[model samples]
Target: MQFGPFLKKSLPKYLFIIPAFLFVVIFMLYPIFYNIFISFQDVTIMNLKGDKSFIGVENYRQIFQDERFLLSLKNTVIYTVSCIVFQLSIGFLLALFFNQQFPMRNFFRSILLLAWMTPLVITGTLFKWLYDVDYGVLNYLLIQIGLISEPINWLGQQSTALMAIIVTNIWIGIPFNMILLLSALQALPSDVYEAAKIDGASRIQSFFKITLPLMKPATLVVLVLGIIYTFKVFDIILIMTGGGPVNATQVLPFFGYELAFVNFKFSLSGAVATIILVILTVISLIYLYLIRKEESM
Candidate 1:
């Protein structure tokens, strides 16, 4: 390979990447670095444009001590875990169902995508009405089915608020998980399953031994993506609960929003945002490692 010819030929391709590179730097990398820098400083509304003094880890320390921050962290964990578990499991089941030749399978799968395709704001608002304590469809259905004597305050109480949000997130996330898992299922080699069948493996046994193992990469991708998306969920919560019923549905993203915009604690919010970034980065790294290991296998 002649270096000069190779460089000339690749120059336009490299040029094409420059715009994308600059966009990432301007939009993503710069914001992240700036947030990290601000997290170490006292960047309140008072000192935002004035003099910002270095506070080191004091913001982080204070946030950890704050009861609301702790609650938000706990809620975030619950929300993320619940969404992932239910989304992945339900999506996998849906994928399995849709993978088999069935009447109206394609139509049903497309219908599921409507939930995923709708904007979060719209979905949140719709669910807000659905979960209304009085005159809500959910309550009416439950009452008709004799599940409860009265309409439950789904987003009103501390006990049920997080779960309500979790359920919404799960509903929004299932289609994405299903589509990805379905694609993986479709791509799997049929020979393996056929061999397993010849060896006297039942459907359940084949799924556990062959399908599950083959689906690991896709499953890992879905899980990591789901965790990242669920952990940073802000809009739905904002629309449905506003992190409320006394901070019941507060997650880290919403908590950070409250700190920055509501309470004007910029540094504290930055700290919270940085914490979220750190968590997502760690999850992404683990996912990469798992993917590489699976690829090697």
Candidate 2:
């Protein structure tokens, strides 16, 4: 009798999850397994050869020896950590500002969404134009204002190229992060502030004690997602510099593309992809564990 009732009640929820379940099974899970299989065998976009020999760990071994792969790993980690730090800091500040009562709040918030809602490809292209050394608005304006002795190559030299991409990504990311964090901030109870004020707690004290603690969930989510998204970055890199002027901006995703399509090393590419997946998986598990621990406290 209990089983029947529970099944009947959960039936609607099962229907709701069906589309998501199917999507993961067909897209995510299958592709991952297929990629693992692909990594074991030396296959390419054209080769119809069926000579299959099990080369255990050879692909991974090649990955460690490849300098580009190591550099890509280093670059991906730097880009991810940097993006998370700046994006979270800027986003939290903006979220706090928007959460407070202000004149024309809605108008300003709508304006902020322009960066978030704009297509990333369009943004990448726009930045590419902005960073162009000659006849570009940035160089033109800087030169006119005499900001520097000469026009800086924003996306050329190894030193400035990664920074340029980071600036563009942070600009695109901050608005979306601000919007989400703002929603969370608004949901915080006003009564908590009142009680803190009664205790003679300053705004700074209350923010540290109440706001920061409550925003833990949001911070954790953003940090995890930012790491993942930054690791897989490609569009802006492709549009802005294409990892040129040396390998300054060659993060993992672009590295994988260069190996697979540019160099036609399909087995090596698959191994690199699998390694990336493992790293992301480990990070995700750690984040989830931290989130659970936070909630428990």
Tens-place lDDT digits, model 1, residues 91-166:
9999998999989989989999999999998999999999999877999999999999999999899889888888
Displacement of the residue 95 alpha carbon in candidate 1, Å: 0.3
- Top candidate (TM-score): 1
The reply for model 1, stretches above 4 Å from the true place, is 1-8
| Candidate-wise lDDT, in order | 0.93, 0.88
Clashing residue pairs, candidate 1? none
> What is the Cα-based lDDT of residue 245 in candidate 1?
91
Q: Encode model 2's per-residue lDDT on 1-297: one tens digit a residue.
A: 699999999999999999999999999999999878878876665662666666888888888999998899888888888888898899999999998898999999999999979988899999988988876788888888888767788888999888888889999889878988998999989999999999999999999999999999988888888788877898888877898769999999898888888888788888889999999999999999998898888
* C-alpha lDDT (0 to 100) for residue 28 of candidate 2: 96
Error of 2 at 232 (Å): 1.1
